[model samples]
Target: MPRLPPAPSKHPSVLGVDIGGTGMKGGIVRLGHGPKSGTLRGDRFRLDTPQPALPATMARTLAQIVSELDHREKAPDADSRVGVCFPSIVQRGVCRSANNIDPSWIGVSLQDTFEDALQRPVTVVNDADAAGLAEARYGAGAGVPGLVMVITLGTGIGGAMINDGVLVPNFEVGSLELDGVMAESRASAKAREREGLDWPEYALRLQRFFSHLERIFSPDLFIVGGGISKRPHDYLPLLQLETPIVPAMLQNNAGIVGAALAAHADPADGLLR
Candidate 1:
């Protein structure tokens, strides 16, 4: 008989980190019991991220958060795992580019940095992918089958593709050239700021953008997420498209919950670092 590879290590609990442009949000998630369909609040915290934040600073902050979570009897100390939502194009185990951090972060192994600081396992995934997974599992895409595409229209338009409940990361549709300009530059929250438009106008542009996306991906389900998702009914009605569209059920909690779910799903991988 052929020999099998050694079994991978596993952890009992996870520290879910959602790294954003303005703040770093996280929580200690035990294997069971958390927000179901975006109820929110299950041991979470948010802290402002420093400008040009060094990888070392990120690691230190992560360590502090995880250490506190570990101190609680409810979560594992030595065996706790960490999952991060990084705003960047992640390739293999390195960050290709960071949207919310210093350019020096390019080519850095964020997983390695966090692991070295906390002496635990760690996994770093694109922020959009994390949020998409959450939506697919417990939010808008729940029970829906086949292709599901989620677009987060915040500072930048972030995207994640889920087919059969799996995440296809690093799909920067936002950067695609539309009419000789970056789509995100004209369609994202940045555009709202640049154009001095409100949600209604922004939603109208979103409708036009989604129309293009529908033509390309032809997703069976499309979800709009991000902070703006909180009032999706208000703007979602304005955005017209061919496919079925809905607001993400998890809203703000989607990222953290999804990060935890990502770590928990890959049980054999131990910590992401």
Candidate 2:
């Protein structure tokens, strides 16, 4: 397996933004020299996602976050770049599919939009992929061997697959069909809430979904993330599976940290290759 290029030392920190359905968040992340070495430089700045979340409106809101975070840093580098994690399947800076955000995002060049808005180079990636990269490098999956699957149980299921510290971007396992329905439709946190399922009920759905994944991919490890990860005891143990499972250590910050890591590495080079 190929190793990821070292993060540039001269620009030890960079801004990472996570664009979500309900909020947009950003922060400066300090890159360290070893595994699990990323840390937030200061408090993260957030703003409500615009109601429509169209490309232009979202870009403006993102610019505000970038401006706020840059101001807070107080020593902005003109050459420093920005990394954004968006809820879509991004390919070569363009969004191929929209999830949670506006349909207008489809086919939009997130890189160009954000760069035009913030006046800096931008690296855009899938939110789940960003979270997985962060976990694989600086959180739960750090130093873990073999294939690791990072699953975010949020409003919808989000997934990332990493092997030997290399990320396989946009895995989209949540879209898999389970029992004739989209897996996330029945297993996601939103589903649990919508159906008023207790932990045990939710675990039953998760068990089916994970078991399907196990039969197909047989990943070595599973890292469950999102706000629900804070309460691993509530659902993790209830589901019986062959693969070892753990909660994400970074919680909500994984996407931000991972986006910074991607920016620091320069995504054009193929992030985490």
Candidate 3:
């Protein structure tokens, strides 16, 4: 891997916004030493996602959140870029789906919307992809060699593929069919909750899903994320596979931290500093 450029010495900070179905949260991520070495400068602020959540309204809300967080910083860093984690498939700077938020997000240029709203350079990425980036850089997959896959088991399974520290964005492995059913339909966190399956049963479902993935990608490491990561021992111990699987470290903060990381790191460069 090539040596990464050092972070800005004078004012190394960026705003990270996580847009979800229910609420939007943002904070200033202080780049301590490198892109992965980021921490919230202040408390993160959140606002309920607007009703209808139209593109225009959401942009205004994001602007407000940026303003709120920017003011909290000791000194306004003009070079601070903005990164947003949107709960949709972002392709070529455009959002391709609107599963949780308003359907208007489809075909919207989210990167442009956020840039126009904040009057600054912006990087927009999928929420799950952002979370996976965080994990690969600073969480479970950190320093791990070979292919690493971050699988978020929430309402749906969201996957992110990373080789070393480089991200392979938008790898939706969850949509794959297993036993004639979408993998997520049977193994997602929502499926466990809806079915009232105990940890052992849920682990079995995860084992099946992981086994399917192992057959294809043969990833070296698997980092399981999402809200369920809090209770890793409950389910992780039950799984038995050749590939090592572990829970995410940053947990809920991964998306925000990774957004900030992505904002600072150039996309042309595969690895984050």
Query: What TM-score, computed on C-alpha atoms, does each candidate reach?
Result: 0.86, 0.94, 0.88
What lDDT would candidate 2 get against the real structure? 0.85
Mark the regions of model 2 whose C-alpha exceeds 4 Å error after superposition: 1-3, 7-11, 34-36, 74-79, 267-269
Instruction: Give the distance in Å from residue 165's predicted Cα in candidate 3 to where it truly belongs.
Output: 2.3
lDDT-superior candidate, 1 or 3: 3
Q: State which candidate has the highest lDDT.
A: 2
List the pairs of residues colliding in candidate 1.
121-271, 121-272, 122-271, 122-272, 122-273, 123-272
Alpha-carbon deviation at 114 in model 2, angstroms: 0.8
Q: For residues 111-140, could you state the per-residue lDDT of candidate 3 as single tens digits?
A: 888888888888888888889877766678
In the range 1-273, model 1's lDDT, one tens digit per residue, is 111112224323566788887788887654343333233335677777766688887777777767766676656456756778888887765989766568888999877887898787777778888888777766788668888898887878789887875567777878776668878888877678889988788777787788889998899999888887887776778876779888887788778877776666543433222
User: How large is the C-alpha RMSD of every model relative to the true structure?
Assistant: 4.8, 2.1, 3.1
Output the lDDT of residue 189, model 2: 91
Question: Could you arrange the candidates by lDDT from highest to lowest?
Answer: 2, 3, 1
For candidate 3, which ten residues in a row score worst on lDDT? 1-10
The predicted structure with the larger TM-score, 1 or 3, is 3
* Candidate 1 displacement at residue 142 in angstroms: 1.4
